[model samples]
Target: MARTPVLAAGGIVLRREAPPRFAIVRLRKRNEWVLPKGKLDDGETPRDAAEREVLEETGHDVEVHEFLGTLVYDSGGRSKVVHYWRMDAGGKPVRALMSDIREVDWLPLDEALDRLSRGYERVFLENVGPIALQAAANAERERRTRLRVAAAERRRAQPAEQEPAAGAPVIAGARAADPAPVRPAVTPEYAAADAGEVAGREHVVEVTAPEAPPSSAREIAPIAAVVQPTPRKNLIERVRDWLRRAA
Candidate 1:
């Protein structure tokens, strides 16, 4: 005789948080903490049964997202097969009224893992835990991306009005039609300094005075350099001229 499989369904109900949390309830028959589940009603689907059982046992509305596959075990000389899913405890919080449950509460993943007595239940958590955490991470990444896009759009929509720093070099912004010229800071010393120009042929302007030519030499030619004329008389001659004038 072929043994018939017992159909049951449940979920790993996840409350969205940093690491996420799971719901655990105590069974009245065994008095052990287990994920909330119940047997399938006649002609009911596994997904429906899982959602229905989760709500009925935990008294919280749940949204079933992904089917987490099934686990088969031996119970009372028959195969008790249960289908599980990854469900979200979505939206705002509400008061959870217990139905067909004893002492139900939310627990951290590690605590929930320790509370589950069955190896199959632990296996389900190990599989679904990473999935739930990864989902939360993806949601956060999408949210940040949306914020960045919004910021960029806002920048594009607003007009640019940034003032240049004080005493900084600025290019003229007005067009040829406007003709508004901004004056630059031009110090006197900077304008007169060497001008950085190349020299013309045959002549150079000397920056300093040169020695006077000897008194014996007369009628000199134009030199290669243009120089300031030195005082023709000696200091002793100038002193004697002043003395004679005083007398």
Candidate 2:
């Protein structure tokens, strides 16, 4: 007949630091340094037990996150199964450490693994440590993203300050300021339409007509030179001229 497995739970508690750290505890009885975990109380769920044990051992109230994994091994003659979750510890400790825990040490993953008294626990940590660290990093990135979004929202909510009008009055002794050129806000769609209209439209130019000459100046005709004609002699004048010539 197979025996029932002894159930336990804990956390890979992460502390916010320069490079981040994990929490481990020293047992009071055996002086064995191990991950913060304990056997589950009756009627308690694994999740709740994990959070409770981590708080008691590490003395920092942690926000429980995703389930990391479970470690199954032999403890004394019975099978032991320990469940773990990713937990984030912030600020200072809210409560004192439990009597079962002698002390708590926050360390980097490699150092924490080396400090553990049990080989199985070390192997478990080696696998899950990266998972916990990644969760912490993701949480931090989310927090920063939220802060940026909040800042952007605030900026959008505030009223924009009015700019001074172009060609503002100059001071008595100050140099006259040049007016800034006003550019129309043209969207790409509008710009394309404007370009098409300009290209299709015909160019119109205006020309001034020359004035006609006055009537008085045009009425006068050109004058020609006059000549007198010699008169023809009558019969009496011809006879007189003949008698005179004969005399």
Candidate 3:
């Protein structure tokens, strides 16, 4: 079976002002703004390839946030599968100096769409834009959650710092103090009086036990006589009958 031609592609939404914008890299030779992408090397995963390609094609270091989708296209009579990803560039921009990449430039989405050479590249941009936005949102939410958790942890930690020193007595002269509050004791005479009052109340109870009737009176039928037999023969008898029949 022929192997699938897999390529890894990465695009950055380089933000300058509010509502951060995507940074499109322009090739030095062609001066065409396009997403940084490259074919996957042996043993390299799609994510690793995408990151490598983005770094190689663009001077800016990037961290991949999420996978965008796969793009299938025909190249030199072979089907090429390009894995797309949303990436965030770290710090300021740098120039891509690889042999294949002539130069790199960051462009706004509108400018990039106008300057990009291929129509398919526009489709890739469209697909990656929403995913990148969602990734940014998720990152913001995670940051907020972490901040809240850290604040809660700090609050929890503060109590321990403000707490009294360990082994310190809670009450001064506690051992010499008169005594803690005590409940009144119940005298035996009082308890007996209470019990006598309770005994005066009328009540009835019904109880039964499996005791045989008096022998002098009459005998009752055995419990076995009332029980009905199941359809199947007992295992012990069946085994014996089987053995006898076999013999």
Candidate 4:
């Protein structure tokens, strides 16, 4: 019987960082250290094969995120093509070796490119590195942005500072720079519709506070009649939140 041309699938499994590193494996019999890839099993898709091979070879679970490209090369007289994907390893490689995988290493992309035994693979990384680096920078920026936003939210979510005791004397201009407390978060759907923007575009809210009804149109309630807000629960609520997140 005539042998078929080779078909394979693999991944550039990353353990996410500033520069992004990839998982590499070495075979016990072979002196080469290369990406973890293998021929697909019967009835398997390229994505499934890639995920499965990485787990089997490196003992690490991963989810494929981006498709890199396909590489075609010759092995003996047969033509072989391997599809590559950019995968998130979820965590560090556990070195869970099956019968085939000998040693696994996580290396910086640039270093991995040089350490990889195949020129074709190195070239692939060279071409993909710039795009990947930009993505990493963007992700890092977004993460920091989220942390800042979360802090802002926590501050906003807090109840306004407690009023002084009923009999306490007011000091003129105490904490005057503290802005008035914000009311509520805008619903995402409203925000989305307000901007009518494509993905990655932000909605600029143009809130025109209803023209201050001339003083004559306003109801002047007695200052003492204003309902005082209740004091909010303190660290206990935060502890509950921390416990919830931990769970």
- Judged by lDDT against the true structure, how good is candidate 4? 0.72
Better of 1 and 4 by TM-score: 4
- Please say which candidate is ahead in lDDT: 1 or 2: 2
| lDDT scores of the candidates, listed in order | 0.71, 0.80, 0.64, 0.72
Better of 3 and 4 by TM-score: 4
Rank candidates, TM-score, best first: 2, 4, 3, 1
- For model 1, give the 10-residue run with minimal summed lDDT: 186-195
User: For all candidates, what are the clash counts?
Assistant: 0, 0, 3, 0
Q: lDDT (0-100) at residue 237 of candidate 3?
A: 67
Candidate 3 has a TM-score of: 0.56
The collision pairs in model 1 are none
What is the Å distance of residue 55 in model 2 from its true position?
0.8
Instruction: List RMSD in Å for every model shown.
Output: 16.1, 24.6, 27.2, 29.4
Give residue 137's error in model 3 in angstroms: 1.8
Superposed model 3: Cα runs more than 4 Å off: 1-6, 12-17, 93-96, 160-247
| Candidate 2 vs candidate 3, TM-score winner | 2
lDDT of 4 by residue, 1-247 (tens): 6668789999877777655777889887876887888998899998899888988888988867678888888888887789888777767556568787778888887789889898987887778766656665676699899999999999999999988889975644435454443232332222221222332334333323334542421222112222233343355565676688879
Candidate 1 lDDT by residue in tens digits, 31-119 = 88888888999999999999988887877788887777788888899999999887888555454545457767677788898988788
For this target, which candidate reaches the highest lDDT against the unseen true structure?
Answer: 2
Error at 65, model 2, angstroms: 1.0
* Candidate 3 residue lDDT tens string, 20-51: 66766667676666777888888998888888
